[model samples]
Target chain A: MNPQPSLNALQSILETLLPQMEQGKFSKVECHFVRALLEQFKNHSRVFAELELSTRHLKEALGETENAANTLLTLAEDLQRDERTEDIGLQISEACAFQDIVGQRLKLVQKTLYSYVDFLALMGTTTQTSPATIMSGPGFTGEVISQDDADRLMG
Target chain B: MAVSKDMPILIVDDFKTMLRITRQMLAQLGFMNVTEATDGVDAIEKMGQKDFALIISDWNMEPMSGYDLLKHVRGASKTPTVPFVMVTAERKPENVIAAKKAGVSNYIIKPFNAGTLKSKLMAVLGPF
Candidate 1:
């Protein structure tokens, strides 16, 4: 699957969220958590960069193979066809290497998210305000729905 | 002196991914002699090692910001005349004015493509 759109979405979310967190009237500890979350996004960004570089290398190889294909068409030898197939296989192997890196990154993101949620829960219990309310602050306008509302919307 | 593609260029960002992406973009522009630094302090250390032809730095970083780096670069006798470009996601007027005052040669916003990078390099280096 193409990671471009997902990466763009993640980037957009980060761009919109960071400045607000920086400017928000959150407590010192809350701001510390926010900074840690930003660090987590750095890991996410690395995964996306690795994916982009892998795809770019794969595309470059395919472009070269296309140029070679023009010459191989006239030659039409079994050996040339095998070599071309091998080149594509090598690209696939290179792409698979990226899959391992992405998997590791995803696990890291998941762990960070869990820790953030736990921190939010702790804050909610201590502050007597929901995590969403604390996050949105006073003038936030984004559409935020509770789990019940989300289920109703899904129905 | 005319800009040469092989001239050493320094790119500094706290984000490793941004450093990688900027290096790739520079490579696409046929600039292969690029150095990466994680932040302003690291950049200053690298500057001590080699005289970079150009420095492209992200504005936001912990401990030492790109703005501070710009000030340091301009104040230092060794690299005072080198072209300095600031890359930032923020477009605040005051920040731009401050960077200009600090001797930034050019500035580029974040999420820029290779074409934008090339254009910024051209503006600073006078058509490389």
Candidate 2:
């Protein structure tokens, strides 16, 4: 048989295999597969940073949209008194459209922020367990539960 | 000499936002010297290398928890007298008992306002 591949060649093979491991199709893979996935995760700080920045911007945009909707509602109410004017119906329609757009954008922003928040919350609270399960016995107590678990418990 | 403005304060918590908020709140409260650790192990390593007047730690952390850090501190001769207070969401009786057993100076429950934090710190540190 041919000599075993060098450490670098083995690492390259594992690196090539990581995507399959991440897809959960290669469940029987070794610890190195998990390590490669974790290493990939560690290098994705920019993704999290962008998500944070996008969440901030989305929040600000939602706030501005809410303010605009409020202002439009006020304008529509004020214009309602002049029922005969052609512009009044147009203003009301525009206001309704603005409110709808604002509502949709707010929902989108909420979903985006919720996804990012949930991801960070997971990272914040997850506890790594060793393969031996030596530290997994019942004596352990009072650790903070993950955000998802906390939400489920509280809800 | 009294604890100067430049003396670092170790703020230990697993949550990054909580750490940032605590650091900001401490800065607002006139404690300018603040350092942060994401967990008890990081806090202990920092404490081992330097002297901090106070340790504000969250009771819940993976691997080396805050209670473990408190025990470690108590066991170490250099930092036995360091004022340690648990700032955690854990309000359970057993946790409190364990913290007290480990010689925690005070316990502050989470969602605590700045005023409550100041009051607890005053209670532990004798009005400052």
Candidate 3:
């Protein structure tokens, strides 16, 4: 009995038998989950930005309303109430414009979510290997997809 | 700038937000007379109805990609000189080469800002 081949010798023998260990790495499903999570992170970021902009717009509108109220209060006492109503109207219009911006941003976020749905579908259908090549946004990653690559990955 | 702000410009994209954002970017550049089409076929229909001073279009679209539209525009009679700019989420060199070979005036990638849009337009329209 050769001491049952020392533990170090067993470790070296195992390394010789299998040089690559694929077991420890994340599977395709796990990778998909990771990619999807990253995508959600991006989606949340967009929503957060939208919310910030919306809040700014709301604040502006509130400030405008307050200005109008105060100015009207002081002016009513002085009998100049009709003078600054136009200013209030203009401010309201500007504030309303913010709604349009928020509307567009929300729509953009919706589109992003829709794309994410397609990605989720791909993840579900793909097997053996990660279906998507982990496509990257302009600044997020460097790989570019061509028409041919797109067809293959999509398949 | 040779191109006037009043000149009609056509923008084609599949996304509504992109259309609005691109229009807003153009507006920031003093271009108020901008028109939009949701896809290539829609853009072709619009193009048939009017002569745009400049045409800005997205590259990826269903049933008819921007490359196909570019080919149609390039092959169309009496519309050879129309400046066509292709915008895309894609940055593949092959697409860029194909677009340039098809006579695209300028190419810009997605996630672009006001500055990139402005510079790309200026490259095509000559310092607007």
Candidate 4:
């Protein structure tokens, strides 16, 4: 058996070399598939980078949200003794602004994801199954059978 | 010149949410006087109408970017010496160099908090 190159490493190498190969001789289907694959790879790389950025932003947003919630909880606990409640309230408000930043970045991520799906469909790689017919959850689509109905069917 | 909390400050960003966030953060830092611009062009228009003590602007925007705005600010103007802080998601050395060449007083990366904002402001405007 021959050793195989890592897909992760191969992707980067191909990304650099594919454009040079774009002008090479090939059949119609081969050309189409190659170009589509190259495009898909670029789009995947972009989406991956966007996802990483969104993940970082989300982590920061969640941390700030937790801080705000904890501050509020503490203020609620020591309502009578805390003199800096107003300052803490303002701090919480400032901390909650993380959602706006995260929301903006996540919107970019969502747009890139949608573009990925569109690219797949364009390349004729998408399945024939209608989006509505696809399973949304474990038990969401199937019929709700009673225990009696199950027993009767089994019997 | 002493940096006063009462001095008018301008924040330019394409995102309304960011404008709100920056404004709220500045308010928390005791800087009550603040103005906003949606883009570099708008910021220039605002600059024409009034003088800002400091300018905090996002690097990316349509029609005119923050780099363009910085150049315009640094160009022949009454407030040419005003401190310009570049806020951006880009961390590339080339970007920092370009901003420095364009006369940016300071730089700030996104995903920053009020504390970070305060530190940058202090660096640019001196202690408040």
Candidate 5:
């Protein structure tokens, strides 16, 4: 029987090369994914930007209503201390919080877009030679980690 | 330590929105004096210029990450012991371990609200 390319360094080589191959495969897939994401990103960015603008306009419009309501409540004893009257202020503040949450989510996708490009750029630079195993974790997904888990890891 | 409201907190993050939200949260908690740094390198440069009561930094930055900044800050005798809070969207145990080992005073995850920011600050800096 032939020397069987020797199981010698084969496992280590496989271990090393398999990961690279996997990453390369991912990089290939991500190239297309990035293009799609970029196109989506353009539309997404425009939509979110418009959404943010529209929300701000709505909030400003509500502010006028709120001012009117406040003035009415103060002058007209009928509207004063009413639950529905008070609810307007509360509702506007809550709605303002909604726009911010949308902004946060929009930022997450933007970061994801950056990561896709960065990853592709990195793989592009290292394709000829062995790619450095970037241990940097996946790109930001806007997920929150628990403090307990954080502490446990610290320990 | 019952820090004061005008404790001169430093907020570091690349995103304008994060910085704005953080500043708002700090303001809500009565931390009126706030400073902003766009990234870890910018943060290090600013910290080198003046001492801040606390440093709140986002973790994934280009070239100089929050982890890299933490290491540099810890290495520098000037602000080595300053309270550094690592803000990140990462959920990796090893990343947390890396920050903690790098001498982070506390950690705040992403999409955080004023309440979470308040609790983290209180935990690290004591009550206002």
Candidate 6:
């Protein structure tokens, strides 16, 4: 019917279904059924674009953290030479702020990476599942297990 | 300010950036004689070649860590009693207690500023 809809249309349907999937009200059978629908819609160009963006964010966040560390080192040297203890303290505070920002960015990147992995698994293109997916597996397998079991089995 | 220019200081850290930072700080404090080591094994080897007045080491490192280095140094007859400082990311009370029990002369937690380093050095060495 309607040429089985394009990949983009299927992906949109899956995207719309995500909120329901996350609501936690769905039974195992219902979840599996929705996941099967997601599998049918996994190969959209938009998903690949999102994955690329997520990877870039991860790299950027890591680079920022490294750069902040290096800057702190240089500031320490300057402060020591001038015997400016107060300034050194201020710089350290600034460095810590950068560290906090980097941590937030890393979290965002991690979430995006998780989403990308889930998208990949839904497409049946990836045999691997994200460590984030504890109760889920390929083919919409509705397996309820402990956190430890999910960690060992998924990653 | 208390350290002598001739007194050799050993800086140990896995990250080159940290080593450079420590060296610069020491230099500013007027300690001209400084040596570098990547980890505990390298620090021990270097210490064997020449005695160091002070050893500043990072706690976490690959192969051999700072704790191991401190133990090795204290265990050595020639190096025993040498001033040792642990610079580390771990600032927990238990970690500090362990390092103190291991005979660390001073403990400087990571993200330390120049003032903290200077104060620690002065506390350990006294005013020059």
DockQ of 2: 0.02
Off by over 4 Å in 2: A1-155, B1-6
Candidate with the greatest DockQ versus the true structure: 5
Q: In terms of docking quality, how is candidate 3 classified? A: incorrect
Clashing pairs in 3: none
lDDT score, candidate 3, position B106: 80
Interface RMSD, all candidates in order, equals 15.0, 16.3, 10.6, 21.7, 5.1, 15.2
* Candidate 5: regions farther than 4 A off: A1-145, A151-155
How far is B49's C-alpha from truth in model 2 (Å)?
2.3
Q: Rank the candidates by lDDT, best first.
A: 4, 6, 5, 1, 3, 2
* lDDT tens per residue, model 6, A58-105: 675677678788988888888868876755765565465444334434
Residue by residue across A11-71, what tens digits does model 5's lDDT show? 3444454455556654666555544444443444444554454444444445544654665
Cα lDDT tens digits, model 1, B1-128, are: 67899999999987676777677778767899999998899999999999999999987665687999999999999989999988765345556667877888887755455666787789789987
Sorted by DockQ, highest first, which candidate order results?
A: 5, 3, 4, 6, 1, 2
Instruction: Kindly give the stretch of ten consecutive residues in candidate 5 chain B with the minimal lDDT sum.
Output: B108-117
Put down candidate 2 lDDT per residue, B1-120, tens digits, no spaces.
343545568889866766766776676568988888888889888977788988899766666778898999888998898889887655455666677878888877654546666777
Of candidates 6 and 1, the better by TM-score: 6
Question: Every model's DockQ, to 2 decimals?
Answer: 0.03, 0.02, 0.12, 0.05, 0.19, 0.05
Worst 10 residues of 2 chain B by lDDT: B1-10
Cand. 3 Cα-lDDT: 0.63
- Cα lDDT tens digits for candidate 6, B1-117: 545768989999876766777776776667879999999999988987998999999887657979888988889899889899887654455556677778888887555666677
Task: TM-score for candidate 4, please give it.
Answer: 0.60
Clashes of 6: 0
The list of candidate 1 runs beyond 4 A from truth reads A1-155
Weakest 10 consecutive residues, lDDT, candidate 2 chain A? A131-140
* Tens-place lDDT digits, model 4, residues A14-130: 566556567665566766655666665665565566556545555655665676577667765665677676666555555555554555455555555565566556555632312
Q: What share of the true interface contacts does each candidate keep?
A: 0.00, 0.00, 0.10, 0.14, 0.25, 0.00
